[model samples]
Target: MSSAVISISNQKGGTGKTTLTMNLAAGLARRGRTLVVDADPQGSALQWAGLSSDEKPFPVSVIAVADNLGREVGRFAEDYQYVLIDCPPTLETEVTRAAMRIADTVLIPTLPSPVDLWASLRLANAIEEVKLRNPRLAAYILVNQLEPRSALSQGMKQALEEFDIPALNSHLRRRAIYRNAALEGLSVYCMGKRGEPAAAEIDAIIEEVL
Candidate 1:
């Protein structure tokens, strides 16, 4: 089968989009060939790949093209089992739209906050617009950096119930391990004991999505 293209997108920055993209890519790489396509001009995912160890499992490609990215990425998808695109945090960008045009699934990572929730709705609206071209496109909201004990987390779930897009049952907690692992150009899976939970969460997401 051709690789499934999954786009990690959010209209708001700092929503853990790049973090989710890299970790999810690493998680999926364990089972099969995986490639990450960094569509954001920021090139954060590309920089992460550079910082990664020489033994890193997967390869990342940078594709900043705003037009015809769907066609460009379709060619890359031929060799890998899975392809993930880290999109810029803005729906106004053609790169984001192009990624959505080809993606089988769009994962929107958002913090558990009122602002992030509102932004997710806007992103869902944009995805709906993109669905016009790619009717098979599926989008899911992933609550990231969640503090389970906080009231905000509980409230965020309740608020999401009102939104059109469904939120994933699994969530990623706020943890320093994610940051530490990123700095070392590693995924949570390589963090040993400290990363076990975080790694499991990423694994669950991969399972649920794929």
Candidate 2:
């Protein structure tokens, strides 16, 4: 398959950008060769993979590159079936824009809160600009940290409707296994039966977006 570049971007910190990037990379790696580009200056992706032991390393290859990130990602795309770029949490930076321009699709993880929705507006503006140049760029919102038994607040749902980009039907819920897998430098897929539900959530995301 020709390389498909997916960029995960968010303007707000603590939006689980790195977590989604890493787990998504793991899912994609299972399907084909996948590379996770740690374009975020924080280097979270790299650090996550670094935690892996040599005996059982991270499932997908990961590397950090801030300089000429778009160009470097293009190079990697030629080799891997999927190249997932983990952009910085802030959208104003050129680094984030660079990744957005080159991506085939962009997934923005958002919390189910009014504050987070406001934060996403700025990102929506950035995406509008990026889409101008790259018309094919498809963007979606993947609701993160969604409470399992809680219903979506009507106000928040109304706010979500204000955005032009549609939110994915699949969402990542608040679960302990996600953190558990991370502590071991592993994706939920490796957590055995304990990871099944979380892994299933990731798999649903894969079905919708990947």
Candidate 3:
């Protein structure tokens, strides 16, 4: 099968883009070969990879190119079954656009809040623009950092219905394990008992995407 390039992106910062990118890459790596391309200059994904010893689960490459990110990622498409790109937050950056242009799917991770949902409209617009160049590009919004008991969470889902992009049914609940795992450069999959729920959620996303 050909490689599927999925770009985990959001124009807003602190939207859990990097976190989702890392975990999703890990989840897919367990089933098949996966490569994560860190297109963000912040290097959070790169840092996560650095924490791994000689037995790194998967390889992560940092490629912060503003002009030809699609071309850069394409070079590895033939080798791996999946290529996940961790894109920068700013929509004004060319790298984000380039990544979207080449991505078969773009996963937008947004916090379930009024401010975050409002800020994500710009990214929704950017996706529309990228669709012009990449007619087959499929984009979906993933509700992240969700507080299930909060009224805002329900409201956010209802509000997202009016947006152009569709939000996935599978969501990530607000959990401390996510934070703990990131500190150790490990996915929730490696956290044993505490990470089971988080790992399940990531698995659901992978199942839906594939």
Candidate 4:
């Protein structure tokens, strides 16, 4: 079967891009075989996966590709049902551009800050450019680390409407469990009750986006 390539990308750092990529892959693995492409030069996804014990390793496989990202992802796509690419933090890099070009859906993870929303405009423009070549590419904004009661969080979707790319209806709240899971090299799904809510957030996102 052909894999659904989803790129977790953003122009700015601190957007929890890699964190979302790992957890999203965990959720997707429940449905079928999943793979994560660690396209970020920082190799954060590799570190996260490395933290897992053999007894309870991170579900699915993760590989790092230094160059020819699209070609590498395409080769692996034939082997998995889902491939999530954890792109480099900056939009200026070819790694980010390559991921967008090959992605069936580009999930641009962003914060609720005004600065992040503005930065997304740059990525939005980049998406349009990629679309010129990849006409079927679809994109969305994923508002992360949300505070449900905060003014900015409540108005996130409305704020995203200003950009060409739409925001996902489901969002992830600021939960210690996400970081906690990271410390242990596990997805929220592997954390038992502590991870349930966060896992639900991931499930909601995958459900809505897919």
lDDT (10s digit) by residue, model 2, range 28-140: 89899999999888888898898888887999989888788877887776689999998888866798788889999999999888788788888889889989999989999
- Per-residue accuracy of model 4 over 1-210 as CA lDDT, tens digit each: 789999999989989999999999999999999999999889999999999999999996889998998788878777899999998888767988898899899998899877788877888888999999998898989989999898888677677777778888888899999999999889999999989999999999999988
Better of 1 and 4 by lDDT: 4
Candidate 1, which segments miss by more than 4 Å at Cα? Answer: 55-67
Winning model by TM-score: 4
Q: What do the candidate models score in CA lDDT, each in turn?
A: 0.85, 0.86, 0.85, 0.90
Clash pairs of candidate 4?
A: none
| Top candidate by lDDT | 4
The Cα RMSD in angstroms, rounded to one decimal, for candidate 3 relative to the true structure is: 1.7
Model 2 weakest lDDT span, ten residues long = 148-157
Estimated TM-score per prediction? 0.94, 0.95, 0.94, 0.97
Put the candidates in TM-score order, highest first: 4, 2, 1, 3
How many clashes (backbone N, Cα, C below 3 Å) per candidate? 0, 0, 0, 0
Clashes of 2: 0
Off by over 4 Å in 4: none
Please tell me which model should have the higher TM-score, number 3 or number 4. 4
